[model samples]
Target chain A: MVLDGIAKTALLGVEMGMTLVLVTVGLTLIFGMMDVINFAHGSLYMLGAYFGLTVVSVTGNWWAALLIAPLLVGLLGGLIEYFSIRPLYGRNPLYHILLTFGFAIMLHGLVTEIWGGQVQNISTPALLDGSVDLVLFSYPLFRLFLLGVSIAVTAALWLAIRQSDFGIVMRASAHDSEMVNALGTDVKRVFTAVFVLGSVLAGLAGVLLGTSQAVDPGMAASIIIQAFAIVVIGGLGSYRGAVVGAFIVGMLNAFGPTFAPQFTDALLYLLMAAVLLVKPAGLFGNPEAT
Target chain B: MSVKDIVGRHFSAHAETDVLSGRVRLGLFVAGVVAVLFAPVAQMIHPFWMDLVTHMFIFALFALSLDFVFGYAGLLSFGHAAMFGAGGYAAALLIQNVTSSALLVLPAAVIIGAIVAAIIGWLSVSARGIYFAMLTLAFAQLFYTIAFNDIPAMLLGVDAVTNGDNGLVGITSLTLFGMDTGSLMSYYYLALVILAGMLALVTRLANSPFGRVLQAIRENEDRVAFIGYNVDRYKIVAFTISGAMAGLAGGLWVPFNSTATTSMLHWTTSGELIVMTLLGGMGTLWGPIAGAFLVVFLEDSLSAIGNWEIYLGIVYIVIVIFAPRGLAGIFQTVRSNPHPKVLLSRVRSALVTYREKVFS
Candidate 1:
């Protein structure tokens, strides 16, 4: 019985961690490539869920909504990059922070105005509605599918980033944009693309998690803080660090309630504080960059 | 002269004029304060307007406190409302459980705010730039979660003090030296006096040697550290001072509003304060106060329109892009250029300089 409880908790942790990974990886990538902290990232995620919900309701096809929502968000993100963010490149990071923060508020207002401030529900598709019998216990098939989808998406992203010529240029530019620019790479286009990719990932996470939870306008405000925490704990701009941090946070969040439900929220932040105290640059981040 | 030389000439001219204008501003400030002090006696202002002004003073103090760390010390704290809310909660709890004296509650609130700031500052000061900002934010959220979710009762086995989302109400007004503070007019005077005192105190601090070091750290941390100064210690001190000031603002808010809510500590509250600070003019102590008044007044008037957030966002974006120096910069520009032709040329030159700074 104890083993079964442990197994269940582990599963829950992985499920939560996958969702977090989807968000934080994108956040970390944007920070790495552009040095711009996208405060609107979570808002984009919220928008994705709202878009997915609207699309699914209108089309009656969940898969089509999933494909379309992220694309739409990515397009919006690209436009934002071109118009607002592109100008504040060489200025202090604070400019981008403020600009993004304003964008987040504006987006939230737009979302509320369009959808009205209500909890939105998205039903699971029929194919993934029931529970699946595991060796030890029955698990929600939808949740299992979510985990699989997250894994597949992450794997595909990893392969694309690791193997492609575009990936090499991206990695190089993140290190030294001036050098890449000198090498005839269009660094501006690269940055725009990176931002779009990040926004798309955020949108994807939104859709994936929106099905399980109720979506509201305020959803972005809360999740963004956690996503930021994940990015910080993992070490800013480090992919492996983000993944590791996500799992640690996800597991802690999953099991913290069992031991002390009230302290669960504090636990995540406390853990982050402790990590920062010990390793100021985060576990995998460069100290010099910090 | 070459453009660089022309810019250099203007810079020196502006500096000389600034010193002269400083005295003029100070005189004007005193006049403004005297006018406000006599506003209650004029009977021309409504009680509702008095209340709004009082609320503006409280937020002005809050924004000023934020400016200490953000504008002066060059630390962008995203969790500053934790200090503000902590002050409010501390004062409320004191009033509810311990004493009804404004004197006691207010001081306790300041101390509690300082203590909270110290703790958060100690943890976060080690990180620089965006990390420092995020760390402060996370810690603030931790406190917010504790207050919002009744975490203290479940974790520490204490009674829920923050009262969850409903917030703590029924805080009675205190009498000070035979005068009741519950009256709207009296509270307005009290808040105004306190704000004036705090503003003077902060202004003095900003002009001191320590303030100079704080500004120096903002400009270049490595250089300051290389000169044998403890950069981390200075940052912690600034954070603590700023937090205490914010706390004082929060403390004043509870008595003025007769309620304290956990929503005060929410991230959005911090964001709003940032907007106020940025809108007024960062790095300028008095700008935040004006910014606060402008924001609160606009919020009051435009709230009926029901799209204040969008307007505020557009305003912020515009300010960041066009007037990076903020509303205060426009005043400075106007002050330096008394003629339209010179002002136009100066504005054009300023834009060119800004573009070069940003794009090059």
Candidate 2:
């Protein structure tokens, strides 16, 4: 029985971790490329979910919605980058922060205007609808699928970011965009691409999350706060740090209720606080950057 | 020259004009206070406006507290509502279970607020810039979650407190110096007096040597630290002071609303306070009051329209982009100019140019 409980908890933790990883990776990437913290990332994630729901309702195909929603959100992200964020580059970080915050409020307002202020649910596809039986316990096939997809995506992204020629330019621009521009690379285009990619990942996470939970406007605020914590704990701009931080936060969320239910919510923040106290730059972040 | 040097030069050039305008502003402020004080007796204004103004004063105080840390100390806290909520909850609990005295509940709330701020500041002060802001945000969300969720009695072996999401209610009315505090007029006057006192105190603190150090830290932390001042200690103190003031605002808020909820501690509340500070102008004590009035008034007026959030968002974007110094800066410019046409023409030309670019 104890072993069964542990397995269940571990599976739940992995599922939660996957959701967090999806959200945090985009946030970290955006911060890494452009020193701007995208406060509206959560809203973008919600938009993705809402867009996916709309597509599914219209076409009656979950797969089509998954592909289309991310693309649509990514295009919207590119537009936002051009119109709002582009002008604020090289200014104080505060401008981007406030601008994104305003964008978030606007997005939330848009979401409410279109969908109405009600909790929304997306039906899981028939293929991944039911739980699969295990020796000791059964787990949701959808959750397992999510875990697999997250792992595959993370792996593919890791390879693409670390190995590709484009990855080299990305890394170099992150270090010194001015130098990269001097070197004949179109740094502004690179930034827009990174921002769009980050938005795409956020949209993907939103769709995945929508399948499992009730979608609401407030979801963005709650999820973004946790994602921010994960980014900070993992170290801003560090991909590996995001993965590690997500897992830590995910497991804590899964098991904390059993151990210290009263303080479970506070535990992640306390951990973040302790990390800030000991290593302000975060575990995987560069000390000099902080 | 550095940006600071340029700003310093601009301020020096306007020093003579500033003194004259500053007096005018002060006189206007004093007149406004006297008007509010006698507003109850005048009986011309509706009770609704009285309530709105009272609430505005509380939020104004809250925004000023934020400005102390954000504007002066250069620390942008994304979770300021934690301190505000801490004060509100503390005061609410005290009023419900302990005393109805304003003297006791208010001070306790302020002290509790300071303690909470100190703890949060201790944890967050190690990081600089956006990291610090994120840390504060994380901590605030943690508090909000705890307030929102119900903990099982079996887990803590105690009854669930905070009442989960429903929030605490039935806070008894405050009594100050044997006055009937239940009346709207009395409550409004009391809040006005407290706000006035706090405004004076904060203004004095801003002009003091300690406040100057905080401003210095805001401009250049490394330079301030290099000069042998403990920058972290200064930041923590400023944070604590800001928290205490926010707490006082919260304490007043609970009684004014006659309820305290988990939403008070929510991140959106913190966001609203930031908007208020930014709209009025950061780094200015009186500007936050203007901001608070603008936000509350707009919220009150526009809620009937049902699309207020869109308007608020657009306003924020426009202000951040074009008027980063905010409404206060515009007032300053208007004060310095001999004619309003210069400002109007500049704005008109800019708008025309922007329209051409967008259309083209």
Q: Which tens-of-lDDT digit does each residue in A62-176 have in candidate 2? A: 9988899988989999888877787677778877888899889878887888898899988899999999987889999998998988988888888888889887788888888
Each prediction's DockQ?
0.54, 0.46
Q: Which ten residues in a row have the lowest lDDT in candidate 1 chain A?
A: A281-290
Fnat: each model in turn: 0.53, 0.52
Give the per-residue lDDT digits (tens) of candidate 2, residues B176-277: 986658877778778878877887787778767788899889899999999999999999999999999989998989988888899999999999998999
Off by over 4 Å in 2: A287-290, B1-24, B30-38, B41-45, B149-161, B338-341, B348-360
Error of 1 at B134 (Å): 1.4
Residue pairs clashing, model 2: none
